[model samples]
Target: MTGPAQNALYAALFGDPQTEALFSAQAELAAMARVEAALAVAQSQLGVIPADAGPAIAAACTALPIDPQDLTQATAQNGVPVPGLIAAIRDRMGRTPHAAHLHWGATSQDIMDSALALRIGPILALWEGRLHAILTRLAGLAADHADLPMAARTYGQAATPTGFGAVVAGWGWPLLDQVQAMPALRDRVLRVSLSGAAGTLSAMGPQGPAVRQAMARALDLGDPERSWHSDRSGPGHLADWIAGLAAALGKLAEDLLLMTQSGIGTVVIAGGGASSTMPQKRNPVGPSAMVALARHAMGLAATFRAAGLHRQQRDGAAWFTEWLTLPPLCIAGGALLRTADDVLERLTPDAGAMARDLQIGQGTIHAEALTFALTEHTALDRATAAARVADLCAQALREGRDLTELARGAWPGPDWPALIRARSLGQAPQEARAFDRAVRAASGGLDQGGS
Candidate 1:
């Protein structure tokens, strides 16, 4: 095979085909070819190179028939792919004058960086749509389960009761943050790089800025005004987005893993992993993969962070580190979001299971609500706690009795039933509705030709 299967058995579980293509050698070569063509055109328009050579240069950039094996061998010597690619284009151009202008006044970094911007533009856009869809799905779930009462756990123990919709909202809100943050991040990272040799654009003269602007316009990328030869902060923003996304999805994965535990059984997912030996096992296959990908991405993102420390005007170490790290990150980002979306689509909440879990603590989960009721009736001295209500709640839990019954015995007039009722998801239902409303507004904005 020319490359790894984009969606082989293992890959399909944690890879995105569209994004995988974006980082392919063919895609990289094609992007660089387009940048070279556009560079020739821009230079031609400025009366720099022969205008007649522009079309020929563009024609030579056509992909296919060019072997990646050849480029790989050439790259070993040249330290970059453009020199090999330019040589191939020139050879394909058949000793014509147009071949002379194939990469006029441009360095390998210029071609590669500009091509990366050209490629990343669409990649960012794809993620935007994906994130928006995930958010929309989460918002719908939140609205549908606004009153779903589930035991909210803290430090791995049931602390209180909360709406499952609120839990879904917790998974979603960070993604909305990412969705809301994408435009700015795109502007930061998808910038055209046209500073030749050492970022001075000394070869292009006074027209360098104009050519950069023209190329940015042609490639549909942002122009960074100054050249970013060693300034990788642009791509760093992309790393932040990728890492932030993984962390958010990791949270979702954690919750799903916990909720689908054999004992909890609160989350019901389709296509769970089956055991080879143990027929009783229905493993959470998708959540496990997504969580693994997220953790892997977190480590890779740290590489990008460490990559920020470049040496001098250019550091081969950092640049090469990015080459090693960034592409996988983009791929993982696509995969995580796609898997999370699928996980949500097939996910169902076992309401009965959640209610049953609330009983496991034998009414100790209602201690907070009981405390509030107690506080409502009378004020307590700062040190009045230890032996009084604590013993009652502990006794209730140990004896498999209801704390509400004990509280009712004590207060006599406090509406004890209301305190333990599922209806007391204080402000959770309203927050769920608010998220639903926000999603609707964003959708409407989209329909009305806004972001």
Candidate 2:
């Protein structure tokens, strides 16, 4: 029978050739090959093997095609490193002296950890690009809609008037913070772990340091002070970063879902999904999917964190758990990024609806500002002016007249209307645009492929 179907995310990550290229299984395999070559060279240089064999072993490794099935079977039997790989290389050399130096002075963890670093390098690059694209789209939206006022809700109740740009800025600020934090995360994820068995390069002696430096350079990973066979810092830090990103995406998705509600109608989605059963339904499918994927990614990160509590010197449970957890986290992150981009792209702002909603609570949003304006001209105190404005607002709502007209009739001050309007919004749009410009400049001109 066919095995249970792989997760749809797996199909996205590993089945689709274009997106699958981001993960680069070949790059991971090549990293392992380089580690093996580095180990042989280090061994030869340290007098553990004949110096003449180093170049030949490196050449043989470069020429060999690794059998993936053999590697899988070996991983199932032992924890890692199919003995078949070394055996296959030895057979190719046919009792030659260079064949004897295949994987000298290194253990399986060296290859596996370097492979993880190689995998993370490409993934982080993709993340930085995707996140910048999404943030730029958000910034553009905020700039375009900066002055369009809408009702702000807290605890599901209408509170005050706020611009759509303010809402977008709320999401943008956190995203900017997350983007700033990514470089450190990238460094942590791209660290090379090349210490031989038992967290020491005892097998390669004095040449170990040089070999590790060379391997890191070849693989484009950072060199660590020592091997972290059981330290578990890299994966744990990666999990934390992934979780934080997912949380931010989830917040944005939640806001989109709320803003698209039928009652709100401040924003409309283009090309939303329609129900197969009900032709009248236009569903917010993209935002819904983002919320689901964010939840999944956060849960996977929790699993990774739990796996970090494994016992010393490589716990099989923790290591194997990652085989199931890490890939899904990567896929979910990719999906979230793609969905955020699409959602921001297709969102249509309803300036008319926002204006209508600002007028919904019977001019309550203008109450305090009107009160302060009235306080300056009248004999009344602040509280009395507030009460008088509240009474006038209630009377205007019942009598079906404009609150501003009523205020003008009741107030004798010549500047009352202008003062109230001026305080309605004070420099909010300018501040948002400044913040957006800073984010764009910091993100290197909104280009996805920039540094």
Please, what is the whole-model Cα lDDT of each candidate in the order they appear? 0.83, 0.75
TM-score of the candidate numbered 2?
0.87
* Candidate 1 lDDT by residue in tens digits, 54-164: 877877776635778898878987778999888888888897977887777778988988888888888887887787788888899999999989898999988888998
User: Residue by residue across 197-248, what tens digits does model 2's lDDT show?
Assistant: 7777897777788888766776677988687887787888888887888899
Provide the global lDDT of candidate 1 against the true structure: 0.83
User: Model 2: which ten-residue window has the lowest total lDDT?
Assistant: 1-10
Candidate 2 residue pairs in clash (backbone atoms < 3 Å): none
lDDT score for candidate 2 against the true structure? 0.75
Worst 10 residues of 1 by lDDT: 1-10
Candidate 1 lDDT score at position 106: 78
Scored by lDDT, the top model is 1
